[model samples]
Target: MNMITMGIEEPWFKDPGVADMFGGKADVETIEGTNIVIRIDDEILDLVELTVARFHDDGEWVWDTPDAYGWTRNINGAKEAAMKHGWSEALLRLREVVPSEVVSVLDNIARMAAAAVRN
Candidate 1:
């Protein structure tokens, strides 16, 4: 599904609420021209939470860091660490609360990824 199908939007990705949790706010946008919302689903929200955290903490996403090798490494490390936590631990919990819907969403994504790899 596209981003709107998964509940993703510009504002959500650069969330003030999420930033405030980390002691700041964020503002993500499109690369050029008008902005658009892609996914509108639980998975998008989960991913947005991760993204917002990175942007808020880093203070230099695409805007400030054009040649972001460090940003790449940071996200890579974070993705690895989150993976080390496993899907259940990494994805299902929002604010330390586990939700079955999140698990179901992640399971679907895992299956899709596995199938793509197998193919």
Candidate 2:
């Protein structure tokens, strides 16, 4: 489903207090542009880009840094590591506001990004 539809269907967005959580506005368009940065040790990774790339070619991901080479050696392992280490204080706070279905949420966002590119 599209983001607007997802927002409408999701009970969280329907709550009046949801707007206050997002600085008095719960715009789906604004949330659509949200970026999630994942850090693995000293390396920073784009969560959306990684999710999209992972599904694009049988789950293979590449990174530029020499240190990244080791991280990408086992793709699933790297993803698990990222999920474990990437939760920032802001994200932890966001988790309290949003549901815990992070994997599903990231997959949907990645799909939307890919569809946007195609159209």
TM-score of each: 0.25, 0.21
Which digits, one per residue and each the tens of the lDDT, describe model 2 over residues 45-87?
2342111012223334322121122235444554444433333
Best by TM-score: 1
- Candidate 2 clash pair list: none
List the global CA lDDT of all models.
0.36, 0.34
The clash numbers for all candidates, in the given order, read 13, 0
TM-score for candidate 2: 0.21
lDDT (10s digit) by residue, model 1, range 11-94? 323333333333333333311111122223434333322331345454543222111112333444544433333333333334
RMSD of 2: 21.9
